[model samples]
Target: MSQTTARSAPSKSDIAVVPPRRPSPWRDRLSRLDVKASPYLYIAPFFLVFGVVGLFPLLYTGYVSLFDWELGDDNPVFIGFDNYVELFGDDQFYKTLTNTVSIFLLSSGPQIVIAVLLAALLNARLRMPTAWRVGVLLPYAASLVAIGIIFANLFGPNYGLVNSVFELLGLDRVDWQANRFASHIAIAIMVNWRWTGYNALIILAAMKAIPREIYEAAWVDGASPMRRFFSITLPLLRPTLIFVVVTSTIGGLQIFTEPKLFDAMPGSNNGGSTNQFQTVTLYMYQTAFEGQHFGYASATAWVLFLVILVIASLNFLLTRRLVR
Candidate 1:
């Protein structure tokens, strides 16, 4: 080998050197800012508010129900389910439960049915449609206190339009607030008047959302309007119906204003002359505030809550079945 050739040849240590890689921008950003922590940070306010407002009051109510607490009392004594036991044994509780369920059935059932029918009508082509819809919703937007006062005047035994009409027709005047059935009917009418339009509008929206093509197909198959409504429209509207029924049930179960106002007359505040119009919620109010039995009232509230839960569950199950 020549000396020049040996000098041109590379040694073993003469190798190309590579620089180390820097981290990606995205990776660096992600490392600095965690997505998991960000989500929790965003959701923490809702949880905090719910804990303070919703959960704390519910838990406190339950705790209070276990003790013998009274309004304007200095000390509360622990009773350990005695409030519940006493409630079950009480006649007034049973009466209130019956009244609540009865009013719920009478008011909610008819209201939903009428509302669905009205919604179906409203969804059809009609003149001045916007005006009609706005008029329907007016009742719902009206003040409940105002509604109660209005109904009270209309159903009053004396100097009321209803009794005046009866007298003009030579029919006997009905004592609306004094009679059990009459009082219930009056309350139901008020409830129906207030909520029917709201529910109808909701169902109308649902009915409108249904694809027109389905109705066209039904018509092409020679289905009549009535047949189409029963077979196609109702089936498709089951979800909306379920929603209205469940909500109406909740509202009816918690009926307060109408009965309270009706009973505000002289010799009438215990829900009527005979407690005939008193609902569970009204009963709770009377017990808690008027009667000053806080523990018992808390027990009543819990019972009412359970009833609502059961009804809601049943409604959901039925809805699922109907959908299937």
Candidate 2:
């Protein structure tokens, strides 16, 4: 038997077709504008602040370096490169440069070594690790002026704790303030003491960020702690080491306060009895304020800035090569 199936009639709503709504030009334009302009608006404040405080001062210093400007001088004479020329010829400038480099060398190498060692120690399992890490940073948080004073007294030639220890060991007391190299050593000690812990914390953070799986595999392969550190950890820490080294170079070269305050001799502002430990910054301060050679001091500052740039670049290159 054949059966016929009846179909139901279609409703008006089912036959009707609805077209897509047209895009709003203003809304589309506003969205596109927001996408394009949002990033710049967010970042504008930083550039504005930097232009006012950082870039303007840097450019102004460079401009002032080309003049024969002095402190309290209303009408400054425009002399092109005269200050730089004079700076190159100045014996005192060369001496200060030497002292700056010397102190930097004394401090930077040992500081990095100690910082790495401390980081390694701190990365190990220990009781109250947070307390230990915070304790290490105390010296960095302390006042620089106080650290300088305490170190100065400790390094004093006579009646200082360091000298007393030397005498106890049957060695003659070395005059840290009067002697140039000794004074550099003393300043370096202070720099290392203050900054090593801070650097160690930075390095420890880097260490903590390294993947644990790699270390676990190395352990399964019978690698010792020292082996794992040298092979896995040190290689992974390259970027952090580069940052630490570059910053240390900059800070070491610009050292002023420690040497300035470490000089315990009465009425001596020249870094020592004969300007023995005077760094570039100390000399620049003396030239600008005491001798009223603002132009010359600006020239000195520019030169030091260039030197720091070059050295920091070299450090980055060298570290990149050595780490690999």
Candidate 3:
């Protein structure tokens, strides 16, 4: 103890502390911008494109619907809601609207049912699955014009294959183009033929997305194939089913080409001799191009748009509920 020497205190040089770097204003600003604005920037292109192509046209059409904008008019007269008022009162408008709804019902109901059945078949283990899938899609890929022409001939009242078959079966020949209900049925068949397989493929894709474990577990629990499909598959497929139903509703309401080409008279814009099978779109085309009533046609188009919106919404809600 007496021989112990005093120890020197540690100096600052022996334990140096590095100072933290100062944050740059530019870097801070960049970080803030990324956090606040990057998500908006990423989605800006979609909004911009929609504004230009979709929103603009829709608004312009509404604007045009307010005016008396015929084809040859130098100045379109602004008639507020007159076109819509007239459209609501017009008998021809009502006729076409009826036809449109009838055709939509006839086509969409059977189309969905057939598509679901077809999807179920396609989902099963099969020989040459790829070939089967591709074959189903071929009709959708084929030219609409060619299909319309072929169907038109096939359903022709005289000497058509359908009529010939009916005669062979001792059934009276159907005037597909002349009779209103018959025309609707014929066009519905054409629509189903063209679109059922396409919808089936879409549903099949959704089926493939379902987890196999659930299916396997259900099978292990002694669930029949039908039970598994109804209990597990359909419940999970509600979203896809809603999508299919809504889209089919929209497309069915706006049907044009099939009805247009089904007309036997060449270059005729009238749906039939009495405009029996004239759909809303066909009527709009006739009013705009043939009758040159652009404003009226625009009104018709808007009405159709609203109708489709309402029906599609109903379909989505109903399908979701039913599936649940």
For 61-160, candidate 1 gives per-residue lDDT tens digits of 9998998999977899999999999999988878878877877778888888898899888988899999999999999999988898898999988888
Q: What's the TM-score of every candidate structure?
A: 0.87, 0.91, 0.90
C-alpha positional error of residue 158 in candidate 3 after TM-score superposition, expressed in Å: 0.5
What's model 3's overall lDDT?
Answer: 0.91
Candidate 2: tens digits of C-alpha lDDT, residues 249-277: 99999998898899876434589878899
lDDT of 1 at 132: 94
* lDDT ranking from best candidate downward: 3, 2, 1
- Runs of candidate 1 with Cα error greater than 4 angstroms are 1-34, 264-269, 319-324
Best by lDDT: 3
What's the lDDT of the predicted structure labeled candidate 2? Answer: 0.90
Q: Which ten residues in a row have the lowest lDDT in candidate 3?
A: 1-10
**Candidate 2: RMSD to truth:** 6.3
Kindly provide the TM-score of model 3 when superposed on the true structure, using C-alpha atoms.
0.90
